[model samples]
Target: MSSKEVDVQQVLNTVGEPTRFRIIELLSSRPHAVGEVATALGALQPQITKHLQALEAAGVIRVHRLGRRRVARLDRETLARVAAYLGGLARADEDDAALDDYQRAIAREETRLAEGDSTRVLRFERDLPADARSVWEAWTNPARAAQWWAPRHFSVRVFDFEPRAGASIRIVLAEGDAEYESRGHVERVGAGRLVFSLAPVDPAGEPLFEARHDLVVTGEDRAHVRLDIEISAVREDAAPAVAGLRPGWEQLLDALDAFLRTTP
Candidate 1:
């Protein structure tokens, strides 16, 4: 029979037989010759051979010739396939449970929002270069933002960017051949504070999140300025994104600091 015609359930059923089950139980501990299997089960060699043949045909056990002796062992690939199938089924069940929980949370949040409840806010703060205009221009200028905005593995592509309020900006990040885009409108712009709302350009981008940034110029020199920043975003699950942002933001700020120190 073709391998596809050999049903996994049929193999399981064949191995479930009393004699075959005992043989499998014995082999579970260790591989053994047909004679050893017979001796362990207190059966004749021929009787063990019959069960062994059936198991081998069902792809449950494999027999290898060793000189004058034949050794049998469980077919590891078949056993692994069975285990993986069961694991996938369990994962599917767990996903169903999580989906139900998410649906309930959404319904509860909707009811709360209908009553005009506000969103939960998560916050972060940082210190930047001492130059106010430099920090402002670094953040507002597409060229400067592109230099340090993205993570190490990503490069930014800013197609349309205007620092003025109500202008639209589209930023694309490229990682190898994979790309992610953020599309949003500039909501507010102050002396050193900028607020925006960004949504992923594609359906595959992360769910809705908000970006709020506040840059405060702390001090200045003839050609240098000190600035501090408070960047806050509301993400679906803030923990992982927050953790990732910590390092990325630090690196970007470091790059910006270096750029300002050397730039004329």
Candidate 2:
């Protein structure tokens, strides 16, 4: 029904009466004649018929003359619309609660940063359908890393990537007209884990902030592996750069998951 034609108050009032509500409940099970409804609900035939009329007028039920008898049935489409409206209300409440939680987290983080907490740590873990060797390759391969290193909406370019310890790493991220670049060194490397650090830099190669990152890969099975990534701020001034680290890593990991699903 059109929004303008929806009389919510009228619908509520029509169903507010106990007798009418009972009749609607009865009709909900199946179509029934007035006499049948009266018999099922132990209601007087005249009273049940009047209740059905009110419900029909409110568009809650449909009545038709079936041969010599009148039959009534709940309007499935209207009931579905009402159900969807109630579901939307429930979803709205959930969204509001989640938003409140996010705001509180942001406030707490801001307070911590303002208090000069030089070390901020963020971690992410995910299981992907790739073996340890393949996962390792994806992480260490510059081209494969570029395919999923950035967030869902951003693009990434690898300037130089060397996974060996003490090797240099540089990456460029682009979104629209904006570009973000970071350079770092692989601190340590092993078969299952790697440690590194990155400093956001300007176009002239000036360091903006510093972060230490640790990545661990564990084989879950012959065909799957679990990856853990942790990033920590190395300086008090790095707080601002690391503030958005959690979600940024999450988005990157999510993109990686998507890539693995489609890669092979």
Which candidate leads the pack in TM-score? 2
* lDDT (10s digit) by residue, model 1, range 144-240: 7777677666778664678889998787778899887777777777766677655453365553445444444434542232222232333434333
Clashing pairs in 1: 129-226, 129-227, 130-225, 130-226, 131-225, 131-226
Q: Kindly list the per-residue Cα lDDT of model 2 for residues 1-264, writing each as its tens digit.
A: 764565767887888899888887888778998899999989788888788888998889999997989999998777677767767767756446544755666666667767766554565677877777777778888778878889755787555888789999888888888888899899988877878887777668866556777788887553343334444443444444555566667677778778877896
Task: Give lDDT for model 1.
Answer: 0.67
Q: What lDDT, from 0 to 1, does candidate 2 have? A: 0.74
* lDDT of all predictions: 0.67, 0.74
Scored by lDDT, the top model is: 2
Candidate 2: list runs displaced more than 4 Å.
1-107, 202-206, 220-240
